[model samples]
Target: MTAPAPSEKALVPFVSVENMMRLVHHIGIERVLTELTDVIEADFRRWELFDKTPRVASHSREGVIELMPTSDGEIYSFKYVNGHPKNMAEGLQTVTAFGLLADVSTGYPVLLTEMTLLTALRTAATSAMAARHLAPKGATTMAMIGNGAQAEFQALAMKAVLGITHVRLFDIDPKATEKTRRNLEGSGLTVMACETSQAAIEGAQIITTCTADKQYATILTDNMVGAGVHINAIGGDCPGKTELHRDILSRAETFVEYPPQTRIEGEIQQMAPDYPVTELWQVVTGQAAGRRDEKQITLFDSVGFAIEDFSALRYVRDRVRGTAFFQSVDLIADPDDPRDLFGMLQRAKD
Candidate 1:
């Protein structure tokens, strides 16, 4: 039932929504993204050290809920995230998440935190970080194909990580593009609202597609993509969902976070079972190549892997160490005697 006075080991540090925002403001959003990229990159560099598995999922007619778990030899982490493309229309976030980080040595949770905004941040950081390795040299402009909840975050992240100063935005809804434009005003980046995806990518060397839909929709066709440009496709994250046409995938050298998971949930789902794709970790660790030539096309088919979330938790653990942006909660059941479970329950009756 109830435990007596708890020790520090029984408490879990929690970062609430307000505290998460405060942390972002404290570190500055772009700066936080840059830092997160570093953290994620570090984890990727030692990719062989991680225990990797595909996220477990429970699907519903309305949406899908997933549990992404991973652990290194020293630390363990997992996240509970949901994807409901229709949530915004119901006055909710399209995606919401929370996660826990545990010490592998003791199997006790060390951190519990909100990851709804954090997911958006990590996804953007992951994309921009990949671009640093995959994008063509001297790339400065980006074409954002979907201007929704993730549009602005993707924009600023590319700026922070890649020094991209110009963003050309397009959306099926003009209002969404306007919202992104209004949000980015005076952010020291030139933001352009465009009427078409083709116009958006006119001079952009990096094209980012982040539309939220649960279907195999082609936001960018093969002809739309030119040589030497890096395409960051962030929206096609689940089964039956993809953004790039198959022709584009065939022509470009695709890099993914995890080949097994991406084959099921990323754009590669549309490709043949034997279709070749390199893991992004390989490219990052120099085990494989990134961009080979100025005329080579590079595509990062991102589907939000567990290792990235684990790394995000790692970053949070480091950032909130001495900061006031978290609260402590008694999460573990701490009894006077480890084996006296019934005794602990009986003592609460008094």
Candidate 2:
């Protein structure tokens, strides 16, 4: 019997976590942060150009897993992220993520990358992007409420985008704070470890809350907040997880990435339906105002939108090409005969 001919396959690029780190290293984290901020801001300004959706989440006894999908008419991107607050005790990150970028025209994946690190980068970039328009002018000091893997990225992005030179850190775990400080060394920012949340926020122009708790924990109380402060609330990004007191949200002029999603996931989740919040895209596009007065309290309730990940994948795809590090894998099969779906089974059996 004649052997079956070799099957044809389409080559797709696969980027591992190590390759992604090398790519970021080669491009320089500061440059990547700047470029990602630009990409996300541009995407936000033209918000009507893309297809958007809230992430689909699967809940388990331990935590939750989520799939966030979005498309820009040309490129499609989605991220798979799991939030297991218990994972840290197992020597794992509280969140582990991966994502794909595909050609919308062909419905074929062009790149697959580990998003664990990318998530941290884009989250920080998004926060800084929002702060650029919402934070007070000449903001110099920032308070980081939670020191985890994301803490250093927030510090770097704020320093690069907002000219923040002083970072005050606080975390439930002293080791987490130490890790943040060590990672931020030589970044030209002064790092201070604070004893409590209030100590961290004292005299800070921008306050970022990126805790990993999966419940309603008030990391920032209304009393601790002062006037003219921009709050980047990043941790309370799901239902049942809230960092700011309801009164703090009621008192401040709040801005969010996507109002509908933020209503369910951000600190505003604790507020009434008509609590009155501004969309960050509107502020970026100049369709609405940001920080109306110098003394007005501004809050950016960030839930990590799909558009930001879309922009991040696009940026990485553009930069990783022509580099020697990426490997090609066949994630999808391309049969020469489109009707040969059953043939795949026969070949496997043979």
Candidate 3:
């Protein structure tokens, strides 16, 4: 027996992974990244308006699962995401996610979408946006250490948003580096695969680290980092998973999305609780300084904040409207009578 479709009020737009890929192809990936960067930056400029809180996390021996929630008073957004570093060994993704946006007025969901791909896009865009303010002027080369699923997106975002012309790629696994290099074929940027992390960052002005390790491991030593470089360290998004050495952080001027959250999950977790750091939002709004001198070493310790996910959801919602890129799902229950839930259930069996 076929069931009748739900009412219009019950339908919510849902963007599947396939549809998300289609939408990305339709709008063009570079354009999407650029637009997302702008949207996230605009949201950061108005950061004071948003309700901010640390993501609720459930930690395990394997990895972490989290619910990141935030709202701008009008629209509320939340993401359900998981990170398991060992999943790759078991032929699964290290990170996977989905998110929802709801209208605060009526508490009904407006949009639901897969966020695994969108997260990569937004994280890369956020990195590029921070580099725009913190990286050295006319920076061209970026050393991408830990070339994994996020490697290509980070490279393309830097290319599209910051005009980076070269990417030096290195990974602990040679195959991973090759994968990134091959995916970037004809991307118009020079791709160089290096044997060592040190070789990768040789002449690069911007260095990004995104490894999928679930422990305290140092991917970048203090001596490996040099002056006048922007370090986008995004791998350390949990309690003990950090990439850079503590000495490196001591010498660098670290910027973060939210101090309270960053202290719990970002690279700066290695530092003291009272360690002085600038907020990226403040830098975006010109309330704080970024890259004060040529010799400055700037670090963006990104732990993937909720507001960033909010902005990404907001961007997707606006783009998917009235398009074939999303399908309507009956996410809400709409009874013929507003107060007749039992009656509606009783009628369902007929």
Candidate 4:
């Protein structure tokens, strides 16, 4: 006898924002970050095996909406994210997102989740992982240039992955820095609130910029960045939006997630179209050099990629096994007869 196909109710597991946060808390944020780092790094190590494509974007005067998709031959994942820098002024999140993971065998979704928080987690984790390879040895301090919603997450990720013991924060808005400082209180790190970006970078071996503006803006100048510092430019993640000065870009050995996407959306966009930049996955897999010398300046031009989101979804999928953090949703229709979908729908009217 032929076995029954999977039921619709058993197909897709949905993790709402509440449940996503619950799963995060259940696993503890730091542990989740660490595990996510591992999972993301694993994917990067096998980077050649997954499908890669630039995110599809629709631009508007206010912001842009994007869909990033990828497949690993066996599973597929996609994320829907929006970047509206002015949203905070209107009491909305600057970045909001959701994602789905599906099986390649049946093209059926296996998991769906709120990826706003997961994106923040994965971005930080990806940065910390890069720093682990590219930052100066014994790096103990990080200069956080934009202390917005992502600041605290970056701080914790750096602490967990790279052993950063202090974070010096400077934002254009002092209130944001203050908010980050308060949020990070008693997190086992000496948090310094600085008045200027120059002051924030002093003695810092790692510099992270996460500003949210859609124009070509220099949050850091060449003169401010000394040698042997790893700059994680998370903020310069869209066309016409950047955080580092062109002079700094000219000086640093820049690394990036996906060169094609970064060429349009990263600080590297400010450089020559043919500008040479190393892919971070090469360093992750030891195919390329990272931090070649103590005096060499290195930069991670991080424009979030689809594979990282895929890895995050994969992590959540694995973590929720045999757990109640996810609730199955009736997202698909399953009929007793494969060709009776219409009949099933008709029966539901009874």
Candidate 5:
């Protein structure tokens, strides 16, 4: 028997991270990650169809803030995130974020989500998705530099996407490394604690950097990297924060999420104006070559693009519909008469 659909007058649900977490947990992390990758890849292949722009950024003495916006004619989305590295010491998240999805036809918001957790998930998913194409075949071991909030997501994504079984971990703070290890205790992967970045990258086929600092700091030097290592540079996403040495970028073939934004935010920002690089979407769409040779060193210069958040928002919206958890507030005024904009105010007086 077919059930009747709910009418438009039916109240909509609003979801928080706690509610969304149940959805995520029930679906399993790998499945969610796979779906997100599929959506992002599909969107990237039709890059010309999107209304894209560089994110709007506001700078402060403590940190930098940003709003990443994008649309595909039907749905428009934006994420508000702040990058304050010093916040952790004060017991706050280094990067706290939230986002919205709107209907372009009317500029009506359809979904609102706390992106703090989703950002970590999507960032890791995007990295693994890019690595699927750019990294060398049969890549197993990964060295995670800068263990923090993003460390577990990175480890889980690599394990789910690339079949990684061994992870070498390192961070300036010992507690952070311990926390990462604790988070992945039952995730079915071997975790090794390393003393230095050199030891961490020691035979690792994949290297992920996710440090939270607001300066041009080089965590990985040219000498530490070996042939066929896929470097996922996630921390050096802003102008001043960098993980790889400039000389390392000189020797390796680098791929970026979006060329223009990455040019200003990725590690390549340290390089010359004409430094050659390929966009990951090109490789995803088979328009460019990836890992040309087994001996070639590759880097994925990640700057947390808007398209990723778009994908994440879409996923959350679809999953939350009819779930009775999401609460929808009246953000738009719908008057009975098209020309009665002033009538809405008069009704409140009654």
Candidate 6:
């Protein structure tokens, strides 16, 4: 006779990439971004309740692979992600990821899902959340310096969350800029394909740099950044990688997610060990200031953090419930008796 089916407790919910895409389309991308921003911001407000740590990374000349983990007493989560700048040259994704959520009490996974697209959404939402507090008032029109997989998401997040009405796109590869413009054709925001980074930033209040280079390079020089503009630098996320010139960091009042991690991987890695930077959580909780004055240069040196991933996973776990977006995977083995592990294996052999 065939073995009995696994118990409900032995199964875990899994969301495939296709299901994730369907879920996003089902809820609408802009609404998903807006809701994710709110969820992330809510977590930031209670940041002290979560256990945080820097991501463990394995670096190579070709790329970097990392494991980001965090817990909020009740639930535990971790994401396995990789960043390979050279992958694009080989027709592969520059980044890819998957994450899991588990119950802290039993240490058993409850949800597992692909994070490549989820990460893009969470990254954009986090940038918009930081900008909500830091960007200059009445800001519209953001310059997207790198029009790659993430460019359109960033533009749409700013529009949905901050009400930005226009986006200027630029890339060293004109085809990439054209791709972004084409994807955003009906996005309800004026999209301009710019000739240069300088042209992209002209008449734009917010400038976002998201290039994929594994070495030290200056995407934006000090002179290119005028006063009072908000710079969202997301490309520099590893030790040897950086996007903004060193002098620009000095001019802008920089903010970050976590000091320990940012000191090692973010644009601030170029600065001194004791570089004065405010934590974004402090700004979210009103303990510190954000965008203190109209003419102040505000820089959000975002180096994707684990808590944000945890927040995103938490959001997905909640949203996928009672929906067909996830399938149950028989991941655990439950024995008929607690101590019948050998008997269970023998019985399955029949």
Task: Give the range where candidate 5 is weakest over 10 consecutive residues by summed lDDT.
Answer: 3-12
Give the deviation of candidate 1 from the true structure as CA RMSD: 1.4
Pairs clashing in candidate 6? none
Clashes of each: 0, 0, 0, 0, 5, 0
> How far is each candidate from the true structure, as Cα RMSD in Å?
1.4, 2.3, 1.0, 3.0, 4.2, 0.9
- Where does candidate 2 stray beyond 4 Å? 1-9, 341-350
Candidate 4 local lDDT, residue 230:
90
State the C-alpha lDDT per candidate: 0.93, 0.88, 0.94, 0.91, 0.85, 0.94
Q: Each prediction's TM-score against the native?
A: 0.97, 0.94, 0.98, 0.97, 0.94, 0.98
The sequence of per-residue lDDT tens digits that candidate 4 reaches over residues 1-350 is 34345476546899999999999999988888888998999999999999999999999999999999999999999999999989999999999999999999988899999999999999999998888889999999999999988999999999988888999999999999999999999899899999999999999999999999878788999899998899999984788888888899888999999999999888888778999999999999889999999999999999999999999999999998899998887778778787988877677666
Across 1-350, the per-residue lDDT of candidate 3 in tens digits comes to 33456889899999999999999999999999999999999999999999999999998888889999999999999999999988999999989999999999999999999999999999999999999999999999999999999999999999999999999999999999999999999999999999999999999999999997878999999999999999999885988889999999999999999999999888988889999999999999999999999999999999889999999999999999989999999989998888987777777776
**What digit string (tens of lDDT, one per residue) describes model 6 on residues 137-170?**
8898999999999998999999999999999999
lDDT of 2 by residue, 245-323 (tens): 9888888999988888999988888888998988889999999999888899999989998999998888888888999
- Candidate 1, 1-350: lDDT as tens digits: 45366668778999999999999999999999999999999999999999999999999998999999999989999999999988989899989999999999999999999999899999999998899999998889999999988998999999998999999999999999999999999989999999999999999999999998898899999999998899999995789999999999999999999988999999989889999999899989999999999999999999999999999999998999999999999898777788987877788776
Angstrom error at residue 23, model 4: 1.0
How far residue 143's Cα lies from its native spot in candidate 6, in Å, is 0.3
Error of 5 at 296 (Å): 0.6
Checking candidate 3 for backbone clashes, the offending pairs are none
lDDT of 1 at 164: 92
Model 3 has a clash total of 0
Stretches of candidate 3 off by over 4 Å are: 1-4
The better candidate by lDDT, 2 or 4, is 4
